[model samples]
Structures are given as C-alpha cells and as structure tokens.
Target: FVSEAFRVFDSMPEKNLVSWKAMIMGYARNGFCREALKLMYRMEAEGFEVDDYIFATILSTCGDIQLNEADSSATCYLETS
Candidate 1:
C-alpha cells in the first residue's frame, strides 16, 4: 500500500512535505520503524524540513518499544525541545 502511494505521489507533477509525511507516518503506524527512520534521514539529507510533530511521533514510537538507550535519548530530546 505504501509503495503504491509513493508511486502515485511521484507521478504527481507537484509534491509537498505533506506527501512525504503521509508515507513516513504510514510506515511508522504499520510497525515499520526502521523504514520510518530511514525515510526521515533521507528527508533530512535532502534538506526537507521535519516539523516538531514528526519528531514527537517518532519519539513516542521509540518510547513504546522501551529500548533503554532509545527511550532515554527520546526523553532527552523531548525534554530539551
């Protein structure tokens, strides 16, 4: 489904942040954290701005996994922002 969506979006003459966000969020919600993070990194590398909401959501997902270091880092990021 996500791949199809990405195909459709790519076919569009104009693309925007929201389109990318939708793909990222879909991956996250579907339990594809690695893909989500990869996409985020790619977006950053391409100079696409990531909004705070995206950060918060990704952090929340990391917290849900309860990985010690990841949770701690997420908490730190949340607290500092």
Candidate 2:
C-alpha cells in the first residue's frame, strides 16, 4: 500500500501542500516516521508554505522532539498557525 502510495506520489505532475501532507501523514501513521520527516524537510526546502494541519502532523511524529528539531519553516508555521 505504501509502495503504491509512493508510486502515485512520485508521479504527481505538480504537488501542492495537501498532497505532500497526505503522503507524509500516511507514512508517519504507518510507522515510517523517518521517511515522513524526511519528506517534510524536503517539502520545506522546496519552499512550500506549511499550514496548521501540516505543522500538527509533523509535530505529531515525535511530540516536541519533532518541533524542537524542525527547521525555520516549520517554526514559522507554528507561530502563525
């Protein structure tokens, strides 16, 4: 299922924040925390704006640890949302 999910994700013509969030959240909830977090970093690096859902989902990966470890983009979203 995850493999298929990634297959679709990789084939996306143009991904917005929603698509990124879905894939990341899926991986996170399915015990693929590392992959999820890695994608989150990639998302931020790609200059996508994070929203409340994205921020909360990312933080849920490992409680305050994820937030503490999040880069400036995530913190910016946290402050705003």
Candidate 3:
C-alpha cells in the first residue's frame, strides 16, 4: 500500500497540501514515522506550510517514535507550531 502510494505521489506533476497530507498521514498511521517526517520536511522545502492538522499528526507520529527533543528541526517546529 505504501509503495503504491509512493509511486502515485512520485508521478504527480504538481502536489498540493491535500496530497501531501494524505501521504504523510498514511505513512505515520502505518508506522512509517520516519518517512512521514521526511515528507514533511520535503513539503516545507517545497514551500508548503504545515497547517494545524498536519502539525498535530506530526506531533503524534513523533511521540510514537520517541523523537529526540534535542533535534533542532523538531525543536523549531515545536517552537513555531
């Protein structure tokens, strides 16, 4: 399922927030926290703002993985979100 999702996502000529949210949530729900977070970073790099829903999902996913509190990127999101 994830692989198929990745294939579809990769093939999209232009991805919007909804498509990114779906992929991120799908990965997080499936125990792929790392992938989800990676996508979030990529989303930001592409100039997509991580809204509240996406932010909450990411926080939950980070909790599940026990993400390091000292990680600068994580701290930045925590502070800004």
Candidate 4:
C-alpha cells in the first residue's frame, strides 16, 4: 500500500509538502509508525521543511497507540528540530 503511494508520488510532476505529509500521516494512521518516522527522517535528511500539521499527526499517532516512547520522541523531535 505504501509502496503504491510512493509510486504515485514519484510519478507526480511536482511533489509538494502536502503530498509528503499526507503519505506520512496515512502510514502512521495505518499502524506503520516505523515507516512514518523513517520517511520523516528521510524527508528531513533531504532538506524538506516539515510543518506543524506533520508534527501534530505524528504526535496524535503516538497518543492513539499509547506509545509513550514514540510520544516522547515526537515531542523531542519537535523541540529539537
């Protein structure tokens, strides 16, 4: 499913931040937190500037799954980056 989304995204003529955010959020919502975080890191490493909505979605995912570690990591990521 994620691979399909990435395929579509790759085909897009102009990939925007919203597109990336949507993909990341979709992954997180589907219990793919590791993929979500990995993609987020990849995006950052590629110099994409993430916005508030991205952070909010990740935090929400952590809360939804009761992952304290993820929540703390998200909070720390937000604070530091």
Write down the lDDT of every candidate, Cα atoms only. Answer: 0.68, 0.72, 0.79, 0.75
* Candidate 3 segments exceeding 4 Å error: 65-73
In each prediction, how many residue pairs overlap at the backbone (N, C-alpha, C within less than 3 A)?
A: 0, 0, 0, 0
Instruction: State the weakest 10-residue window (summed lDDT) of model 1.
Output: 66-75
lDDT of 4 by residue, 8-41 (tens): 8768887678888888898888777767777787
Highest-lDDT candidate:
3
Cα lDDT tens digits, model 1, 13-79, are 8557987788778877766666666677677667788788787676666545633545554456457
Q: Estimate each model's TM-score.
A: 0.64, 0.67, 0.79, 0.71
lDDT per residue for candidate 3 within 1-81, as digits (tens), equals 998999999899999988999999998778776677788889988999987788678667667434554245667867776
Q: Where does candidate 1 stray beyond 4 Å?
A: 9-14, 62-81
Decide which is better by TM-score, 1 or 4: 4
Candidate 2 lDDT tens digits, 3-50 = 799899989999987899899998867766556767877887889865
When 2 and 3 are scored with TM-score, the better candidate is: 3
